[model samples]
Target chain A: MKCNAETIGLMHKYLDGDITTEEEQQLKYHLEDCEACQEHFRELKRTLTLIQSAERFEAPANFTANVMKNLPTEKKQVKYLRWFKMHPMLTAAAVFFILMFTGVFFTWEQDNQLVVSKQENLIIEGDTVIVPEGEVVEGDLLVKNGNLIINGTVDGNVTLVNGKLIDDDPLDNRGLMASVGEINGEFESVDQTFDWILYKLKGFAKKVFSFE
Target chain B: MEQIIREKIILVKKGDQSAYEDLVSFYQNKIYQHCYRMLGNAHEAEDIAQEAFIRAYVNIHSFDEKRKFSSWLYRIATNLSIDRLRKRKPDYFLDAEVKGTDGLDMYSQLQSEGASLVEEVENNELQRYIHTKISELPPKYRSIIILRYLEEFSLKEISEILDIPIGTVKTRIHRGREALRKRLRHV
Candidate 1:
C-alpha cells in the first residue's frame, strides 16, 4: 500500500476520534492494507497511552487552605471603587455636591461685594457698616470689603477683612479687637479668599457629614 | 458534581472565602498534576498551581460565568508554567526527579485486566521514560501534548485553554506527536 497523504491524514483523524462514520470507513480500509502506516499509527498510540498512564502528582493537603490564606487583601481603594460601582446614585450625588461646593466657594471668593455677618442689627450706609450703639451683637461678626463701625458691644470676636474699623468714641467698652485682615492688594485678596474657602468648607463638612 | 461547582462559583463570586477554598480543593490534584507534567518538578508544580488558584480568586470578577471553570483554571496554570519555563536557567531541571514514577506503589497501579508482572514492569519503565522525554520537549509542544493525551481535552477545549485557533491546536498536536515519535523511535 502506498499510504499516501490521504491515508495518513485519515489515520490521524481516526486516532483523534474526530472523523465521521463515512471517513472512518475509508481510514479503516486504508489501515487494513498499509503496513507502514499501521506501524506509524501503533507508535503514536503507544506514546499517547504511555503518557495517559503516567504517574500523577497530587497537591499538598494544605493547598486550598494555603491559597485562601495567601489571597491578597483587597485594598481600600479597590473596595471604594467597587462600592461606588454598586451605588452609582450615591457616587453621582457626591460628585454633584463636590462640584456645587467648588463653584459656590470660588465664586464667593472672587466677588468684591460687601459680605457682613449679623446683618440684622447692623446699619449699612454705602460701604460702611455701623453696629448701632447699645445693640448687642450676638455672635462673632465678619466684615469683608466694607467699613466696620464699632459702637455697640459685640460678645464675640470681630474679624475684619478688606475693611476699615472705625470706633465712634475711640474709648472703652467697645468690641474686643480680634484678628484683622485688611486686603491691601491682589496677593492679600488671594490670601483672604483661601482663608474664607477653608472656613466655608469646614462648616459645610460639619453640616453634611454630621448625618453620616 | 457540576451543581457543586456551580454553587461554589456563585458563593466564591459573592466573596465567600470558604467557597473559594472548596473550589480550589476540588481541582487541586488535577491542577497540580498538570503543573507537575509541564514543569517536571514537584516544588515548582505546587507553587505554580497555588499561584494559579490565587490568581483565579483575585480575578474572579472578570471571569464570565458562562465558560467552563476548569478551562479557565488550566489556562492560568498553563501560562504560569510557560512563564516559569521561560525564566528557567540552564541545569535547573538537573535536580528534577525524572525517575519519580517510583513514588507510586506498584500494587495500587495494578490493572483489573490480568497482565504478566514482567510486562507491567516494562510498561512502567516505558511510561517513565516517556514522561521524562515530555518534560524535555519545548514548552509549546509539551503543553499541547499534555492537554491532548494526559488531560484528554478535546481540540476545541485545548484551543480555548491556550487561546489559539482549533486549526493551530490540531497542527501542533500533529507536530508534537511526530517529534515525540522520532525521539521515541531512536531509543
Candidate 2:
C-alpha cells in the first residue's frame, strides 16, 4: 500500500479519532508498509503527549478564602435601591432641595468679580469707576465691588455696592428735576441669582399692594 | 452533587452571598489550572482565577440554568487570559518566558493521583523544553491546543468555551498540533 495524500490526512484523523473504520484500516496498512509515515505518526504523538504531561499547578492555599473575602455583596446596594423605591416622593423632594441649594452656592461663588453696568461711558481706573465729566449716562447706572466717582450727570438711578460714592451730581432733586434721582447704598438691590429671585417676588408683591 | 451545585447557584442569584463559597471551593483549582495553561504564568493564573470567580458571583443572575456552570467559568477565565495576552507589548513575547519561567517546577508539587499516570512523560528535560516551546505559539493556537489536550476537553466543549464553531475548533487543533510538531522537530 502506497501512502498518498488521502492517507496522509488519514494519519491526522486517526490521531484525533475522526477516521472511519475503512479509513483507519487503510491508514494502518500504509503505516505498516511505509517507514516515513511511521516516523511522522511517532513525532506527532510525542508532541501531543509532551504537552499533556505538562504539570498542572495548584492554587495557593488561601485562594478560596481570598475570593470569598473579596466577594462584594449585592445586598447592600440592593437594599439601598429598595429603600429609594419605597419612598419615591421623599426622594424626589430631597433631590429638588439639593439641586436648589447647589444652584444658589454656585451662583454666589461664581459671581466674584466686579460687574459694572453702562460700561460704554465708564472709565475704570483700577478699582474706581469714573463717569467722565459732561457725559450724560442714559440707563440706570450700577457698580459692584468698586467705588463710584460720578463726575457726569446720571440721567437715571445710581447704585453702588461694597463701596462709597466718591462724588455725585450736585443738583438736588427735591427742588428741581435733578439728574441723579436715586443714590442708593449697599442695602439697595439684589445681585446674586437667589437674591434676584427674592427681589423679583418682593417687587411683585410691593407693586400689587404695598406701594403708595 | 449536581443538584446541590445548581441550588447554590440559585441561592447566589437570589442575593444569598454566602452560598457562593461552596461553588468557589469546588472549582478553584481547576480554574487556576485553566488560567495557568492559557497564560503560562503561575502568578497571573492565580489572580485571573480569582477574578473569574468574582465575576461569576457578580453575574450569577445572568447565567442560564440549562447550561453547565464549569463551561461558563472556563469561558470567563479564557477570555480574561486572552485579554491579558493582547495587552502585552511585542518586546515581551520571548523576554517574559526567560525571566518568569525559572520558578516553574513540574515535578515538585504534583497531585498524587496524576503523578503515576502512564501519560506522564519520562524525560523531565524534554518536558521543560516543550513547556517553553508551547509559549511560542500565538494565543489563538496556544489556547485551543491547551483546551483540547492539556485540559482534555472535547472538541464541542472547546467550541462552547471559546464561543467559536466546532469546525473552526477542529481546524485550529490540527494547525496547533502541526505547529508544535514542527517546533519539536527543529530541536
Candidate 3:
C-alpha cells in the first residue's frame, strides 16, 4: 500500500528482470506516485552494471607452470586408499581374516601339541594297516584291532580276530579252507573292537594328562 | 569444449602428465581471476589459484566424471579463497551490519551525480573503484558477487559450487548486491 526502501529494493529486482508478476505489479503501483524510489532504483541498476562490467585480472604468465611444478608427486598410494574406500566391507573382511590367520599361526605350537597327542593315541591303537602290492609273507599272520588289506601273495595262514580282512584274490586258497582266500586259522568278527580301543585310549589320556 | 575437457580429464586420471598440464593451462586464468576477484590481492590470488590447481591434480581420481570439470575447479578455487580470507581476517562476520553509515549516507552518495555509464566504461578508474569496493565487502558476500557476476554462474551452479542451498544462494546474492551498491554509490 505504501512505498519504502523495500519497495525500492523490489524495484531493483524488477529492473534486473528478477521479480515475479505480483512484485512487478506492486512496484509499478508504488512507482506511479513515487519519483524518488524510481531514481533510487535507477542508481542501483547502474551500480550493478558497473560491478558486472569490471575487468577481470589476468593470471601470472607462469601460473600454470608453477602449479604443475608445485604439484606433489602422484603417489600410487591414492589408488589403494580409493580402493579401500570403495570396498569398505571387503577391506574390513580381508583385514579380519588376516588377523585371524595370524593369530592361528602364532598359536600353532599349542595346537600342534594337541594334534601330536591325538596322533600318539592313534599309533598305539594301530587301527589302519597297509600292505604293499607284490610283497610275500612266509609265516602265519595275526592282526588285532586293525584292518588288514592283502595286495601281496601269502604262503602262510592268516587269522583276524578283531579286524577286517580284505583280499583281492578270493580263490587263491592253498592249504586252508576258504571261499575267497587261503586261511589256516579261524576268523572271527569283533564288532566292538574300535569302541573298546577308543575307551581304553580315553582312559589312558585322562590318566596321563590328569584331565578331570 | 566440454567433451575435450572430459577426455583430457580422463587422460589425466590415467597419469598422463601432458594432459594434466593442458588442463592446468586451460583453467589457470579462469581460476586466477575468480580468486583475484574474491581475494582482491594479486599475489594471494596467484598463490591460492596455484594451490587450488595442485589440489585438484592430487585428488583428480576422486572427481566424478558426470560433473563439469570447470565447476569443480571453480569450487576448489572458491573454497581456497574463502579459507584464506577467513584465516587472514579471523574476526570478519558475514551477517554484521555495515557500521556508522545509516541509509542516509548511501542516499546522499547516490544523489551526488557520478559519471554516466558510458563515461565510467571509457575510464578504468571507475572500474578499479568498483573492484576495490567489492573487495571491501565481507568475504562471504564478495564471493557470491564474484561467482554470480564475474564467473557468470547460475544460482543453481553457485549453490553446487558453494555447497549451499539454492535459497541461501539467492538471499546472499540479493544482500551482496545491496552491499556492493551501497559501497559503489559514492564512486
Candidate 4:
C-alpha cells in the first residue's frame, strides 16, 4: 500500500500503538518502502519523545506570593460574600434600602398629596336615615319619641326620647334628667311596672353636703 | 485508605489549614504541570494552579468525601485554566506569529553546527514545535491531550477530573493526539 497523507495520518494510531494487528502490519509494510513516510514517522516520534523528556519550566520564585497578593485577599471578601449569600434576610435588607433610595430619587417630583373631606353630614326627616358601616356621625344624635337604630358608629353622645332613656350596652352611662318638669328621672327604666333606678341617692347626698 | 482521606476531609472541614495545605501540596505538582501544558506559559500556570488550590481550600467544605480529592483538584485546576485561557485573547496574533518565526530561525541558525547541532537544536526545535502545535488545539481537546500525554494521567482519572465519560475522554484524546501529530508533520 502506498503511503499518502491519509495513510500517513493512520501512522499516529500506529505510533501510539492504538491500531490493531492488521492495520499495524499494513502501516509497517508502507513504512518499509517509503523513505518520506519513514522520515515523517521518525520526526513525529522524535518530537513526541523530546516533548515528554523536556525539563518542565518552573514558575518564578515569587510566583505563588504574587498570585496570592493579586488575589484580593479573597478569604475575607469571599467569607463576607458567602455570608451575605447565605443570609437572605441581610441581602433583602440591602435590596430594600437600594430600592427605597432609587424610588425616592425617581419619584421625588410626583404629587403625593392626600385630601380628606368633611366626615359627617346627615338629616333624618322620617323613618330611615341610612349610613354605611364605617361612617362617623360628628354632631349630637338627637331622637324624639321614636326608636333610633344606630347601624353606623356615633362620634358623639346620643339623646333618647319619652324620658325613658335606654342603652343596651353595659359600658354606656345613661345620664338622667333632673326633676323640674324638664325631663326628670334617675335614669329609670320601667321594668314590669316597677322602677329600676340606675343612680339614686348619690345626688341627694351631694345636696346634703351643700346644705352647709 | 479511602477512610483516611475521608478523615482528612473532615479535618479540612473543621478549618484545619494544615490538612488543606497537605492536600494542596500533594496534588500541586501535577496540577501545575497540567496547567502549564494547557496555558503554555509558566507564570500563568503557577497563578492558575495557586488559585485552584485556594478555591479548593475554601470550598473543601462543599466537597463530598466519597469522591477522590485528586479528581476534585483537577476539576478546579482545569476550570481555572480554561477560564484564564478564555479571557486571554492574544492581543497581537501577528506578534505571536513573529515570535514563532524568530524561534524557528534561531534554532535553524544553531543547526549550522552539524550533527551535534542535530542532537541539541533539532531536539529543542521539535519540542518547541510540538508545544506550539498542541497550543493550537481547542481548549477541550487541548486539555484531554495535555492530561493524557503530558501529565500521563490514567484515562479513568482524566474522565473523573474532567467530569466526562471515559469513552469521551478516549475519543478526545485520540482526536487530539492525531491532530497534534498531523500539525507537527510540517515542523
TM-scores for all candidates? 0.56, 0.56, 0.56, 0.47
Residue A30 miss distance in model 2 (angstroms): 1.8
| Candidate 2: stretches off by over 4 Å | A1-5, A76-212, B91-126, B185-187
Q: Encode model 1's per-residue lDDT on A65-130: one tens digit a residue.
A: 888889976446646766797899999999988997788677776868988875478888998988
> A1-212 in candidate 4: lDDT tens per residue?
34466666577666555688888888888888888888877866765664575335455555445434543333455456556868989899999768855654443324122211234554343533332344556655544333343445555555443233323344544442111112212222222211212122343457768966
Q: Lowest-scoring 10 consecutive residues by lDDT in candidate 3 chain B?
A: B104-113
- Which stretches of candidate 3 lie above 4 Å from their native place? A12-18, A74-212, B89-123
Candidate 1 residues lying further than 4 Å off, grouped into runs, are A1-4, A20-22, A74-212, B91-124, B185-187
lDDT of 4 by residue, B82-166 (tens): 9999898667342243232444443343445345546777557655656767777999999887776777777888988888998
lDDT of 2 by residue, A1-212 (tens): 34555666787787778999998888888889888888878888888877876666778899999998888856786566656878999999999778866765665566566768855777897778887777866777877767777666666766665455654545544444233332332325444555654654565568889658
Alpha carbon lDDT at B172, candidate 4: 81
Worst 10 residues of 1 chain A by lDDT: A179-188
Error of 3 at B76 (Å): 1.0
Q: Give the TM-score of candidate 2.
A: 0.56
- Whose DockQ is higher: candidate 3's or candidate 4's? 3
Give model 3's docking category. acceptable
Number of the top candidate by lDDT? Answer: 1
Superposed on all Cα atoms, the candidates' RMSDs to the truth, in angstroms, are: 12.8, 16.6, 17.7, 20.0
- Native-referenced DockQ of model 4: 0.12
> Chain B alone: TM-score in each candidate?
0.81, 0.77, 0.80, 0.73
